[model samples]
Target: MSTETPTPFAARPGFVADEATGVAAHYGNPLSEQRDLAAGRALVEAGHRAVITVTGPDRLSWLDSLTSQSLKGLAPGQSSETLLLDPSGRVEHAAAVLDDGVTTWLIVEATEAEAFAQWLDRMRFLLRVEVAERPDVAVVGAFAGLQGVEALAPNGLPLVWEDGWGEVAEGGVAYADEPSHPARDWTYRETLVSRDALAELASSPVPAAGLLALEALRIAAWRPRLALEVDERSIPHELDWLRSAVHLDKGCYRGQETVAKVHNLGHPPRRLVMLHLDGSDNVLPAHGDTVSIAGTVAEAGDEGAGAPAREVGQVTSAAVHYELGPIALAVVKRSTPVDAGLVVDAQDTAVAAAQETIVPPSAGAAAGVPRMPRLGAVRR
Candidate 1:
């Protein structure tokens, strides 16, 4: 659990609790709040996220050798993201990274902070680095260039982390082929502030958007969250995360080999897609809900039915967007046809799902080496 201080915004009028995230779900009108947030007229209390600080001269270099992104040369006030992967290249943890010359700040999900900090500390053998979790530090999120937020930073630097999600970072690669990806218009930022600053803002006139509003925007932008998008078998290629988080040409890190092999020789087993859910029933599919090709389930229920509907994928995140009635991000088998009409099983109702490709089925095999004929097989 998070060791962070409780958010003061919860006491505000119209606040509804989102226990899973430990933040206010909404301040009554989630749609209005989302509009305000996207227009840069509101700020969000992000106490559900935690801050971990790594200080000392060796911080950058030491971090560089452990994560997927190249970090040794990060400039002060620079923003980037890196993933800590298991030996076989499965995502274990993710953090939004920022450097302030004297310290490197890692903003991660609150639930993962303690373990993440402990793991980092254990890895610091003889390195001149000291890792510490800052429970007193809180996070505030808003659209980039929103005024007044930066002033709340305890230090002059603000320790702000501008998200690099939509654009491909240096040495990175992109799998999404849209002329303009939804994420390209996302200009989100997170600023670290002291607990006193959070209370000050809660009492201020600055408008507040809740987690519900933020989540709607995130879903519309097709941004993947670690807690939602990642699973035991997840890889960067599956979610098109290489666009921002993975530096394809970076020096060796823990999972570098698997990353290289998958990009060069094999395709990811699954791919991410956006689902425009049927909102006629006004029902939203929850995370882990079944997703399958339309008609499969209904057909299976007939008197002398065929095989039951096989789950092609599962919904990772879902939300009701102001402009887009209902939308979700799901990870499905890569071989599931891109043009196939899909459905989501929500509350025993078959909700039609229109598929929008985020990561294409042909998302890997970057090296593109020619295939050789199989033994005793005739060549076409």
Candidate 2:
């Protein structure tokens, strides 16, 4: 009684469909597949992603005027991402972008395809650009070291997009200044492939991984996904999205003023963190689960019988990593103590969690403007 369209890759052995994502959750052995994927020994079918194309001499400049990333000077075969925010500076949409000279391909979440394409079409007034979804096109993901991925490109131009999350992008700033950032080793890449190519791979010797493997690796790297991490109140600063999807020096856009003001004079109200969950119970916290201060629970234990733990944040994404065990990314109040022990409410049990800061409490106010003395203030 499911309405999900069957993926072309479903014919392979041990295929189990993810009811939520409409893609393969795993091919029987997820942990082994995760190791193989990290080792460049497998490929993952990202069929849950949608492809859109914009073509014309004005495509680059048109996009540059609207998104958070500067796209006017995008060179051929360059990979970048951009954010579309509401007028009030809340994140609305995001896409992985690649230009192949003749066309600019946008790879986005399948759930975002219709609305995103409709918005672009409505915005195209007398512009030379044309917007259309490429249903015939599909996305395949792999680590950077995977061999022969370049040959899968159409029109002799490589359509692979290598995300720039490992280092701070040009005209971008980092709030996570940890010396050993996990994103330092992130080398994920997504390539555009035709349906015929997908079928060919399904019948060939290329080993396949699934969404489970990819999600585990992505969570381990602390990579944020638009569909998972973004919410109605999300701002680029909260998730450290400015480090990749935002260009601080870009020209006027809908949310530019708020972005600048928060970065230079104010701090974000919330910060993103990675939670190291205790795996003893083997319970993984689901998205939107309430996160509470463990100290509050302990203090309540010292009191009479029962007391409620103080809510601190909410878990955004979670996964059981191949080597790291249970891990998750959560967004907590900026004032939450960095050293505070936390717990996630999972299946009626309090699972202990340790915080690894991704965005610090001190994030924002980048201009460092000196404070001016108030009138009639006494000098010490």
Candidate 3:
């Protein structure tokens, strides 16, 4: 694995580089730009994400058959997300989906584009769907306010998938809203720009930002990214991703059975939480660092011999938001008390963390409303 990241924007002057999951961290001033972008006043390069195209008549239905979202009737220009899971319901891949009438676009981390395309190709099995990876189209990150970013109504608006996760979308339910949701103002979205057009866009006077700025806002909103936030044991419930990535009443798919079984009966083994890290040391914990409760193991489970607070979780995404300093997202054991004070082992020093529940311990048994069975299932 290459420890270095690719810098697509390095051609621009003042474009310093750092690694972020095999991609550039930022050009400069990630914190300041984060605030600007959060308020929808600026744009940032999302060179880390890649696009894959699925065409042919069977595109929508074929994709619906393989993933965890309702895509069969996806209208042209509609935005949604889907989870590709193993039969056991462990999250395998996540894509920000959008249909342009002629093709279905799968926006995923650059690292997974090729492999995920190969996986989809292997599953094509005589289906009319044609899977093709399109590195030609790049993702540019920004919010709603930035002018000239909207899609043209004539070309069906360039397949811009307005992020629906921050707000409740149709055929979904919310599990996080306590103490006020951080996504209340998260209008984050990504737009596809031609590789040739990037130089001009990057040179535009809008003022560029970096991944660090984006991460801060994303972590604050508790948004989970497939590259950094997931592991082999991850499931949708644990990250509270079902809000927009799932349709509880969708037709059968690969892991539908397990998806239903868990939400209805079994509780997720782990839960997602946002941590307010201690900034006293001016140190931040990186992803994969240990996150343990302050109390002893016996205090966590009353039976075992005394041990330093058991490792409850690992930091998945961490950042210093301009507004919320030193924040991170971690997946802790479901049994880890929400009110429990935790600490992050940042290499050598320990940093205190205040837990803000994203997925509560009682996060099972989904509450969905009566569905009057898809009347004619509107054709898109």
lDDT of each: 0.88, 0.87, 0.82
Model 3 TM-score on a 0 to 1 scale: 0.89
Ranking by lDDT: 1, 2, 3
Higher-ranked by lDDT: 1 or 3: 1
Clashing pairs in 3: none
- Residue 73 of model 2 has an lDDT of 92
Model 3 regions more than 4 Å off: 1-8, 11-13, 20-24, 149-156, 297-307, 366-380
Per residue, candidate 3 scores C-alpha lDDT tens digits across 268-343 of 8999999999999999998899999875534445666576667999999999989778999999999999899998
lDDT of 1 at 329: 95
Best-fitting candidate, scored by TM-score = 2
Model 1 local distance difference test score: 0.88
Write one digit per residue (lDDT tens) for candidate 2, span 1-380.
Answer: 02265676688899888887666789999998899898888889886688899999999999989899989999888989999999989999899999988899998988898899999999999999999998888788898778754334565687888888898888888899757788887888898878556767776777888999999999888788888888999999999999888999979987999999999999999999999999899899999999998867654447544666789899999998999989999999998999999999999888999999989999998889999999999999
**Candidate 1, residue 260: CA error in Å?**
0.8
Can you write out model 1's per-residue Cα lDDT over 1-380, one digit (the tens) per residue? Answer: 23253567877889887777657789999999999999889999886688999999999999999999999999988999999999999999999999888889999988899999999999999999999999778888999657777443443576889998878899889888757689877999998888666767888778899998999999888888888989999999998888888888878898899999998899999999999999999999999999999767756457646757868999999999999989999999999999999999998988999999999988889899999888999866
